[model samples]
Target: MAERKLLAGHAIRRLRRQLGLSQVAMAEALDMSPSYLNLIERNQRPVSAAVLLRLAEAYDFDPRKLNAAAPGGGADAVRRRLSDPLFADLAIDRHQLEEWLAGAPDGAEAFARAYDRMGGGAAPGAAPDAEAAVRREIERWRNHFPDLDAVAEALADELRMGAGDLYGAMAERLRVKHQLSVRILPAEVMPGLTRRLDLHARQLQLSEMLDPSSRSFALAEQLAQEARGEIDALVRGAALDRLGERMYRRHLTGYFAAALTMPYARFLRACEASGYDVALLERRFGASWEQIAHRLTTLHRVGARGLPFFLLRVDRAGQVSKRLAGASAAPLAEGAGTCPLWNVYEAFARPDELLTQLVALEDGSRWFTMTRCVRRHGMRVGGVAARFAVTLGLTTGAAGPLAAAAGVALEGAAVPIGLGCRACTRPDCPQRSAAPTGRTRVMPERETGASPFGFAAD
Candidate 1:
């Protein structure tokens, strides 16, 4: 630790300000001259181990966190962001990034954020917005927050309800402990809102339109308000913008609600016993297939992990609505429109049934997928059922738990699929909607080919 320089100028400044102590006050407390502290805070001088210890002692922080920072993860992430094709035009080097991070942390962050969303939208690399960043984070973490999982599990123990009665238990807990009564109001009375907390009235009002599962979910979200300490800790660690923070917080709240309903320990047991049967699990837990698919992705607790599943939701227009990734793999779709070959889109045709497919990507990875159409929990869209198709997929071999139910599916031929039409290069795909970039379209005057467009490479 003493051998290497620890340039924590921005962190030190933040810590000092967080403590509400001025530079001179902090320097005096740390037994250092104000000028020297200023130099350290400005990154003109490296903070030594002794100074780090003194700062920790004076500010009640862990010195080891600073010592362990190494090159600072921010610089590394910025370098990776620069490497993306979106930033190919920007010629930012490592040294420049380090200096920017050290000298003007706030300005550097704003610049990086601006650079990330250069042209806006999810067209190729233009999507560095809070939603996309949170999506990437969900994929990176495999949609599982262990600390939140533990908290949900402890709460589940407190609720201690049987399979179908978790809702009543939660409501009762809210009523008895929090002095909050749960009231189901008509849609006309609640208007478009599904759930609202009236603190003055001590009531948690719910629209009568919400399904039982969604009502339980709403209560769980309210219950999650009390888990803000852990949630804030996790959110702060992410370092998101205002919108990004709110998005992540909402996602985490939903996660807590799901975990509270299923509870990791029991959910895993039910999953194993049922061999990943979505319907059986839905019946057992009184959750929708959508909710069951979501819970399946979160069984990544250490020493008791379930199969790492990938999940995605797509509407009839082939627009992606929800995306969840496996512990070992990235999620399926990057943008709204995805490959037409996947059964997630096909499931919409048979809305009530579970559809399974074995698909092989261009990369030679075969995934066994189970897809089903699901209605949105509590709301109608365009005066119709807000329906979406959800899919759960994992590597072919790892899907052994689903062998019996998905046996015929596993035995089926692997349909070729790609990331999406915009990013895919499968020239021979009959379902190809648009020409892949860098491919010259070839035409035959006298004959029509299997695909709408043929590439010169073909």
Candidate 2:
């Protein structure tokens, strides 16, 4: 197959405009003729490899930005929006859609945003919910923030701390730099609260019910709030118009907490050396299973990177609370709990024990998954504790190295799984809760198969 030429004219124009550079100036920087640059910017000519290298060397531009799949890169998202059931009757062609995405990128993005706001309704100009919009933005970015990683790494170096001394260093910094005392309070005084900061008294309060690791994380979260300026700048640079200011700040703070707990370079090195061992890393860093799994999803730095793992947190009731995918992992669809056959659900049966599985999806793709159940500390001794199953998985093709290092065999028969019952097309799934949509159910007379619901043969 011939290699496709990169044609990201709109991206080029946007970058130039952002840098306050005219076409002539950009062309000069790239050592290209102004007319040729104009043609490239108009999508009439492809951005050649030489010019791509020149842009990188001269302007310090990210080469990925000139690729069609860069963040906010193309109209694929808009096309997916238009293909929804609401626009089924409207005749639209791929070429015309591409033209719109290329020539009028902003308008196409606006249309996509409006469609999202409609929330699958045919209604016009429906207001988008702020929380939902922020959630979508977080999903879009795959819950990874490189800027937060950089800031956290700098902070960790400045404090002269590693994974072991992170909590002590942060607490000392809080006391010396910010004059805030860390206090462990009883659950009665602070009901249903894990951590609370008293700005007036300059004290950070933590619940006594929390374990040592949880208390340390709470302190790191408080320190993250102090670095809100850096996080705010990152959110602003993201240019997510739908994300409300408050939601943006909250998510960024969460990012900071995760980053501070697992500084990028040190964590990445440890992950590689340990073959992505969750328990070992948790013990080493004084972090929890959920925290280690969540940190695995954020190893997206340019040069250094860990396995492209996807993390999923599901409650005992099977509701997915968080899902984050690394750069190379396949995305988990939103609004549906994964198939019950996956080890993620089974993890609840064996709490705190690492369960490994090879899952084969409906699309014929396979993945290696490891899951463990995590318990959240309650405010009181007899209080109900919240339990969640956390799963980390990678594509089977890329799982060889980590699986070998972690002493997991990849040659086992894989468990058949699906996105969800509603979306899955697997026939005769014993654990299937509901029949897949668009499939006709068949009922035999006095002769039922082992499976609950039978579907008509194709």
Candidate 3:
């Protein structure tokens, strides 16, 4: 009973104190007897709308704020919080829990439990079944294709084309073999056509306003579909997690197309010459920042030169769209991709802005990242369009050799950024939506602080 009533009791007491309202004062404001207000504030009685309305009317408080003071987790809040997957082990009545906590104390305690359990092993005595399965399958695939690396190596060697040029080949293939014509219609004519591979007519058309880099990327994607069979063969008889398989297959196909245009050896040489400057590489290969970043991470495949690279992309929601590696073999899981201080989130507020950040991973690995927002297919004869941000990253240690010979210092450099509000642990981040459980907030509490969570560095 005490466990069940603790959060509500805590909330009512806190609210009363924060508002500087005494039991007598609150009773008068809500038209209730002082004893009744005391009982409710003590969790001896459930908060009722009558009391809720009275408190609001008298105190100028939002009713919802009062509700966050509820007990046992609100039904909606619980459901939304459990949607994070970290709470899989708990036998929670999500709806009931959410409702119970609804409009009350915001379940700050529950959030703390969720965070504590996230990185821990699964329920007692269970052998991390999902992770084992994922690794087992990936290993099985690796063993089956002793020659898999050779195949990627060979293909990487053969396809020495640039992104634009490789995509152009695909466009040519569509036109010449399928009798499909490639056209650059204005955003109005084919507002919806971001690169529709019209199988019926064998045509691939895109908006004329499409940026050159995007045009190339779309073309490469189309080429991936055309070469799907060859890609599927690379992973034949191997086990892969659902997301892993999807990413691997798609990665291979796109890589094949990139290899075709950029060719391995030549591209590596150029990367070295350009000091791996993203913009310079964009101009050199006629690829978008995304494609260049993708290729940079792929440089770790076997015989290719230089340090390993990890590529990550985040949108406004802090959702990672792409995560791949050039050298480091970090496990790929959706939940693990977020870090609260990864500067990628900042790029969204300042669109078309390029920002740099240095991020330190949990294990002490540090990375250098460049972030910017890039959108495609916004205007049209008529349509709702697509907008997103693409953040590129590489290791500071690995970047030294690959970067051009220019005199800029590249060591121990990074820009700080966060993955998203829910996943990041960095306290005192003004942009945080909710205070992550356990971590202390560094920023001073402010009435109108720029950061949503009212955080500052300690």
Candidate 4:
């Protein structure tokens, strides 16, 4: 159906965007021209079987995704439909369609086509690209010590307070100092009101309709921008980049704001007494699911006493947000830890479900993940109306009592996890969607099998 094709096209386009590739850039990589790439994107040119294989080989894209979603029909019918003589009435040619099919990559052409179908997409509002800013800041910080990451595991156990407490303290400071009004506006009001901070009016409005947890996080994020300068300054040095300087300031201020609400000593005590129950911690700090997740990862600063934990956040469709850790067994710095089998994706379609998994990394680390929905209560609004879930996971060695508190029964021993499929070296994994890098086919038909990739003698 047209609808199914559109959905598939949209997914392909999304992948292209996430990888930060432009149509021209992708065409160049795939050894094709940009104009022909454009036609394929419009779905006017069906992706050739060969290009699909190449995409899987290069990027680890699930090859099944391209062929499985389209309606059942041969490539020839698709070509005829595109080249229908009705187009000779329009002077369009079949050779143009064939050329696009033969030369372009799957995602490049699809992205162009989707754009044309959408009638030209527009940039979202300018509320600041927080993710980019955060990465820049974090990377700058990492560059400074080149060694701050060295003591994560040991320091995680030294910092006695749950990371949540520090974040909480920062949130409180914002509320009292700014007198920023925090309200739960209805879904319709979410657009203009969710993150409106009118400094002149001395008012901060948030959509109340958001789950109580998300409401608190939005407030905390705003407050953090102002409150934690002193804390962040303590770590200041010649290492911070311009953007990192700005974001670190915001992060520290947020920490101060959270500290204002939930002081370190006090929050630390609560975690000890409550046994680090995240749900209980959620109630204790008035924070959202993700806020609590972030707090868990930050438990490594000075004097904290807890096992090292690494945290990763992935959305429904597999876009990753935060990757933080004070742990050795984590690979948070390079790429998102994604597994197609991860139950986190289910949380989007089934909002009420809480899925847990013990994932293995290719390097042999085991991660304990908890996935649930974290939605901004809205259908149509200026702010994003899309509700997504977040998965908070740490290694099994550092999981502590929280797993028991949540009643999560551990599964079989951890499975191997990779930073991302491309950089992974796990051979013979059934879940692999693409060929591992450096793979080359020695035997042609012998390589034919359910698995898209064939064996290559390393």
Ranking by TM-score: 2, 1, 4, 3
Q: The CA-based lDDT of model 4 is what? A: 0.51
Better of 2 and 3 by lDDT: 2
Off by over 4 Å in 1: 1-128, 161-164, 377-382, 403-406, 409-412, 444-448
Compute each candidate's TM-score over C-alphas: 0.73, 0.80, 0.53, 0.55
lDDT of 1 by residue, 126-209 (tens): 545777666644544557788788888998887784434678888888988899999999888977788899999999999998
Candidate 2 lDDT at 280 equals 85
lDDT of 2 by residue, 253-307 (tens): 7778878777889898888887777778988888888888878877766567677
Please identify model 2 stretches exceeding 4 Å from their true place: 1-8, 16-30, 34-132, 139-142, 161-164, 238-243, 333-335, 403-412, 438-458
Q: How far is candidate 3 from the true structure (C-alpha RMSD, Å)?
A: 21.9
Q: Best lDDT goes to which candidate? A: 1
Cα displacement (Å) at residue 179, model 3: 5.0
For all candidates in order, the CA lDDT equals 0.74, 0.72, 0.53, 0.51
Residues 96-187, candidate 3: write the lDDT tens digits: 55444433444544552333233222455543333333323332222112233334345334333423345566566556555767777766
TM-score of 2: 0.80
True-structure Cα RMSD, model 2 = 4.9
Quote the lDDT for 394 in model 3.
Answer: 59
* Highest-TM-score candidate: 2
Superposition error at 126 for model 4 (Å): 23
At residue 48, give the lDDT of candidate 3: 70
Q: How close is candidate 4 to the true structure, as a TM-score?
A: 0.55
